[model samples]
Target: MSTLLSLNAQSRDADHMLEQALQQWGGERDLWIFGYGSLIWRPDFDFSERCSAHVHGWHRALKMWSTINRGTPQCPGLVFGMLSGGSCQGMVFRIPRDYGEAVMRKLWLREMPNAVYDPRWLPCKTLQGPVQALAFTLSRQSPHHTGELEPDEYRRIFSQARGIYGTTLDYAQATFDELQRLGIADKALQRLLSYADCDRSVESVAI
Candidate 1:
């Protein structure tokens, strides 16, 4: 019980971090958020504008374990995380200054529950121009960073792991479908989806 309480306390510290970051903003202008994964399809927050944006020095990869929203501790699911390397093409959202605090609070609760992600302000290039946007990136040293895994491991997680939001397979499919609609092609994600579909077919045959 003490351990659980301590964990919860640590998670709440993310809220404090959010407050500190906001203080530095000075409420002078709009806030921009860069989304490379689920946020692309389900922002769940009000934004004044959004546009296709690119960020250098980092790329999106399914490198994090989702032990809450997409799966449990026993059967962890996979999620996207920004890692240092190539570039990533994603979406950047502009939140009105008046709404920045509220929207950021909601985002913090959604993404920083375990404080596993390191939120940073990154410069994103949009069709309009360059904008400094907040992005959640994962450190390679983090325990939740999956680095690399076997195809079978991914198949098992997609087939069997589920959580409050839904199955990991569904999450991956939604992200892939959304990216396709946006005219973005991700070959690695395509292969992952193929593995998931193959797993489902095998299960259907067994049933």
Candidate 2:
């Protein structure tokens, strides 16, 4: 199938999900979204305020298979997902109440094209205070969740997997760079990038 068609087919019931979230939110205050990965650097939507935030019970992990954005079906790439356990430090964006629905629609289109994430209202702590923010988390049982992979397999996918956006290596690098710029430390991600970089260097020498 064509890329556009495939993306459309993979989309979840976004409108319904939005409605559910809205009902649960009660239109009481601004909408906050906790971004852990690409959203940290590439939040395509406008926001009223942004802050460094922390959320408990979920940690950033390169555990989700990307079939369309970062790789193909035959060579799936890994993307960052919020998995159960520990905590995560990231950015939280607040959308004004008037723009909440519109911003949410855009977010769903970008992040929820596939039904891999379980959207949840997570409590996040920022310097200003604590706020409940929307976060996309993955369940261990989900098919897209890659619990672990052999080193060779991981390197192969990282080096070779490319999708409509770009290579998985580039995506990982971008995330790592952004986190560093924000003074956030993620040793696991740094190690993964080191390995990928070494592999690429070896390939260049061989070539």
Candidate 3:
């Protein structure tokens, strides 16, 4: 279909842009990626090793508006983003050097279709050691950025928002559960989980 081809082309273009961003910001060694959102729970990628990691000057917030995959433009869903602030705890994945470019392309297609996320290589402190990992963060200037929303606004959206990917609540719930399994407690996500109802979070397995 013409639409499919257009999407593929768009993905390629995004990958090209990401390559440029990394060229200026990435380190010169092993490829590591920092994931704090759904990628934390469902990293459909191949990596040699993964470990708990933390990055300073950034924290996760459900402040990005999803026009697709999770909601429509008229009634957008909220998604987690790495925002500038305090430190954040997340998962770091180490990819084999041979597969770095391939994985970067895949990641670009997945996370960089728009300017909502600014891809950058950030220093992540992993238990194994310190690693500079590529991360997708919120662009404060982007139209899709919501800064912060009240709990009721989050609950309203989580209850009704769904897209090709699934419900917004499912995404939040899965991330919360995954963090628990990793023994990494994110109090912020937990608060949203409470608003989203952690009691029935198991039903959010769809994400």
Say which candidate scores most in TM-score. 2
For each candidate, what is the lDDT?
0.85, 0.85, 0.78
lDDT of 2 by residue, 1-207 (tens): 001111243235666666666776666689999999999999999998999999888899998999889999999998999988988999999999988878887898898776567788888999999988988888788899988877787789887999999989989999999999999999989888877878989989999
Residue 142 local lDDT, model 2: 86
Among all windows of 10 consecutive residues in model 2, the one with the lowest summed lDDT is 1-10
Q: How many backbone clashes does candidate 1 have?
A: 0
Which sections of candidate 1 miss by over 4 Å? 1-12, 201-207
lDDT of 2 at 134: 88
Can you list the residue pairs that collide in candidate 1?
none
- TM-score for all models, in order of appearance: 0.90, 0.91, 0.84
Q: Candidate 2 vs candidate 3: which has greater TM-score?
A: 2
lDDT of each residue in 1-207, candidate 3, tens digit only = 000112224433665566675565444556888999898887888999989999998988888889798898888987888878798899999988777777887887788777447666788987678887888877577788887688888878888889889989888888888989989888878788687674347467755
Model 1 CA lDDT for position 193: 83
**TM-score order of candidates, top first:** 2, 1, 3
Candidate 3 or 1, higher TM-score = 1
